[model samples]
Target: MTESTTPGTASGIREFRMPDVGEGLTEAEILKWYVQPGDTVADGQVVCEVETAKAAVELPIPFDGTVHELRFPEGTTVDVGTVIITVATGAGGAPAESAAVREAAGSAGAVAAGDQAAPSAPAASDEEIEPEGRQPVLVGYGVSASSTKRRPRKPQAAPSVPGQPGAAEGGPRRPEAAAIQAEFNGHAAVVEGPTGVAGAAPAAVRPGGRPAGSAAPSVPGGRPLAKPPVRKLAKDLGIDLATVTPTGPDGIITREDVHAAASAVSVVPAPEAAALAEPVPAAAGPAREIRIPIKGVRKATAQAMVASAFTAPHVTEFITVDVTRTMKLVQELKQDPDMAGLRINPLLLVAKALLLAIRRNPEVNAAWDEANQEIVRKEYVNLGIAAATPRGLIVPNIKDAQAKTLPELASALGELVSTAREGKTSPAAMQGGTVTITNVGVFGVDTGTPILNPGESAILAFGAVKLQPWVHKGKVKPRQVTTLALSFDHRLVDGELGSKVLADIAAVLEQPKRLMTWS
Candidate 1:
């Protein structure tokens, strides 16, 4: 709050500046303030959290001092460098001798000691320090250049123990008892999972006065009831099932009820059907050539691929996998209530398989740089999905993809695809990609020796899904299968290393359960 110094010189007051709130947000609207006049703040304390267009970010105080004044009021739009709060620092308390303050204050830049007032000095001298690398100290106002920091939480008053109903305890409530009660009463049932959905199944009920187990009359002022899934579909689409006439067997609602309900709500796009509905629109320009801007992800990818291609003596490896078990798992997952509403494409399985394979052969994920004279091996997976958008090719990765569960990975893949399609992907999202998977299969291509995204040692190409004749259980039969192509920088990766990585991926696809086994 106060510090001692020369008669005219005083301790400098520091101001905390607001940070770039959003990823690319240049300005923010100050939503509200937690501190006001006369509030004591510690360093790295969050005084206010501001909301940007995308998300809310908390701004922290840079210095520990008493709040002097809030320059801008709440709801005011502020630029980055604008100082939001001020703290008065000096030796003596508020009212002090003006002579001592002048003696304490040196130039206007450094606050004078003794008096609470920073010495009144020439403003011209303050401008000289800007180029010298010494940041200007506030005359009790302005924010610093650093982002806000979080403060430690203070202890709260203790609560009474559950069993010891009357007596107060000096500690937190007995966690064990509450945990036991939670387990027994299935309180955890209501707890939402990482997917943000509650886990408990809804209670079952029968129509009319009779329970589901009872032998109820078929036509006692009754109508056939739709299944839970069907009912849910109808509710989601705002469809009134009572108004619709059922033409199902025995006049019972069928799967058609849900399909009809969904279609009535919104028509889903069928890419293949749309293609057949009209001839493909040729570009107004020449069909032989399409130019794309070399910027952002595409530019970065081109640079990396070219560097990897020329720098790392490249070697490619391929493997044809039956993936019969993987296909079977996809079918099983479609029926799974947990995996419902997810895109159960082969690429999802391939991503899981690649993650499993990475765990087994972590060396394949390494990068080689002769110029830097270094080989970088990363422990975490920033799994990049090579997406071909209308603009150009972009590989935006899901950060920490290896740490996510299969369902989480599927969800992330869906988001990445959606984000890329919407052209809302951030430039930061496309950087620092460790390993990549190109789903060439989407374009109906069998396989291609895909280029390795620069910085990564290897890339896995997932080919088109197809049913082909193959040997299964030592017998010839038709089975769902696909080919996996792996391209690697031979400079850093070798034939043995590439083979192990490819084989591990194929093994997981051969018996999707191998994922659990390897991981």
Candidate 2:
């Protein structure tokens, strides 16, 4: 099976393989298909929506053509590099060979390893095939040529007759006849039934050949039925499927079931002891439970945070700052004609100050390359702004933020915020961040030790600004003050470097005019 464009045929048939939307993502579930067979599709038209582990991405067809066939149905999880659809480029009726190929590709039980099947092609000579068309390249993604050979399927077992001797009353016999015959003959056997018991009727027995009322032999439990995304959620939360109650249709374990089980277990005082004791009654538990599966952005964020927290040596430093001047400057910028129609807030200045600090202390903007045993210092800044969306926490960065002017930066920030709120941030917009700033101020929090984004060296947490009594120029007065906490990877940023970066940000925010001289 392979992607094909049959030669000498008027209609140029093309197979569209699933793309790796996120970096290193192996598979995605087809949430919906917009076009079906015989539907006319133009170049760059979205034909389907797929939900990967990272996010739900809309896939666009690369070339203009009429939809020849949809190889897979909606809700099917397809591996990256597997052909999902076919397009006919030329006009006229659908070819006969196309129908045959589509049938073979759509056959049940034809899936290979990783749940992917190659697209079936016409059995034509090599000379009949023409050069393939230009492959589609999605932004921030690389394309790879994948083999179309399908993996060999596992051999199916022969059906067993019930009530036969040496076989369970209702199930196939363990240590199958071949094993028992091999033991007796001292060699491998090809016999289908146990010796002298081919048609003999056995007594009433339960599974594992135990008497009807006797205890049955232990065996592995059946797995819970759930979608791939739900299964991933359970795995990330470290919840066992067997322990969860099924509430979905057809006795399937839904995402809500997994979350409810997790919540119930979380409130238990001692999990180990509770597990050893008898189960709690459903009526005795909470009246109503809302369980949400951690998936897409949320799951990725959790795994990345755990890895960053444990792998990188984090050293956080805090500083109380008088940002009265910066706050005043923000008010003035809001009215300035140059900054019109742009978001003008404390975060704008704070972000600028952080960028300036990074420029001053370049070493603080480096990443730890454990594979090469070196520190990779970045020349430009891809400043990450951590935005908390309904889906999860995402940090989409401003590309080359070091070069953007105040107005440009503000506009970018506005677009980033709006896009994040609308849940349209692309995977590329969230990658290659050098440093991150999480403004806890929006929630009116004082400050917190922020965790570093994976692959970045430092993170800055901006606290809420408040009026506090302070000595200003030998006088006691109310001053706008805030606390800033900076967490950095100690492997790349030393204590001195971290302190300098934080101090520089504080100094600029305090003076507001120092940005002119320092930067």
The estimated TM-scores of all candidates read 0.45, 0.63
Clashing pairs in 2: none
List, residue by residue over 172-245, the lDDT tens digit for candidate 1.
32333323322332121112222322223311122232222221112222333443334544564455444333
Taken over the whole model, the C-alpha lDDT of each candidate is 0.59, 0.69
**Residue 293 of model 2: what lDDT?**
52
* Model 1 lDDT on a 0 to 1 scale: 0.59
Off by over 4 Å in 1: 1-300
Candidate 2 achieves a global lDDT of: 0.69
Which residue segments of model 2 deviate by more than 4 Å?
Answer: 1-14, 36-38, 53-56, 65-77, 87-292
